[model samples]
Target: MIYNLTYNGIIKVSREHLSNKLEVGFNTISTAFKYMEQSKLFILSRNRSGKTNCGYRVILDMQHVNFESILSEVYHLKAYEIAIVKDEFKQPNKYQDLAQNAYISTLNGSNSTLNYNNQI
Candidate 1:
């Protein structure tokens, strides 16, 4: 929902607006928005009427990763390159293979290994 709202630019989304769009309860939407706000993923503001309005501001763009469309844009990049970059930035010392193995092992009951000698 945040992704959709912030896709093009900052969007002011109220709790009622999100609840109506997602077909969920008002408290559920508010809680989710609060979680995202606390995580610094979005900025929440209050209007003169004291209603909630959330946005991913231009300066506060840590919410970029929430956009599925952005990920789809990068899907054509080589998998190894993606893994290497993610490992280097997000998980130091862990190669793509090791990361894949660990992730798969968590879900599939099989271990994955890293080819430490290979440079992705």
Candidate 2:
């Protein structure tokens, strides 16, 4: 949903809007937004007066994400399996950069770590 919104150049959003679109409660959307912000996937800012919407800048740069580690840690996938899946991609370099950035982001302390390796 966020990716779609970002793709459409819609950065500003409200909890109510998301709630209605996702068919979820407002607080659930708020929590999800907060989690995304903490994950560095979104930059959230408070709106000015008379506005209920919040400014959300979705971070779509693949270089900043670590798909390998995320899949391994979060989804319990093996490195070899990840390698196989990555090989299926037409442009595997993109995934390689994402793996590298995971190491970079961890060293830079920009992302939460879950047993990330020191070597890239």
Candidate 3:
């Protein structure tokens, strides 16, 4: 239920709302959520509006250290690194001359004045 609800972009969900769909009492759902938290399977937050009013939001934790989690972290890191490298090396076909000139200028000297002027 949580997976289905969160598969879209809804990060926050209530315990009562979950319980109603599952056809269980609020306490039972709350207890199961508490167990999941204690086992480090997921993270849970209080409703903050007391027991009668609000629903708890569930957040999936990234520190589980499982193979799937490790793979996910590695995949994300590699993707971002590739994107950064791509952005750093990007040059328009029409502006290739300008890009090459800039690259050559940087390679020609470590000009502190030019670097400072560019930053300013």
The Cα local distance difference test for each model comes to 0.48, 0.54, 0.50
Task: Give candidates' CA RMSD values in order.
Answer: 13.1, 15.8, 19.7
Scored by TM-score, the top model is: 1
Candidate 2 matches the true fold with a TM-score of: 0.38
Clashes by residue pair, model 1: 101-112
TM-score versus the correct structure, for each prediction = 0.39, 0.38, 0.38
lDDT of 2 at 77: 76
lDDT of 3 by residue, 1-120 (tens): 555424532245677677878899989977886765554434455545665675467455423334234334533446566456345434334533443444223544664322222221
Candidate 2 lDDT, 8-95, residue by residue in tens? 4224566777788889997898788766654543335554555745444333212225556644764477988878755654343333
How does model 3 fare in lDDT? 0.50
**What is the lDDT, from 0 to 100, of the residue 107 in candidate 1?**
31
What lDDT tens digits, residue by residue, belong to model 1 across residues 14-39? 66766787799988976776655554
TM-score, prediction 3: 0.38
Residue pairs with backbone overlap in model 2:
none
Top lDDT hit:
2
What stretches of model 2 exceed 4 Å from their correct place? 5-10, 50-120
lDDT of 1 at 74: 28
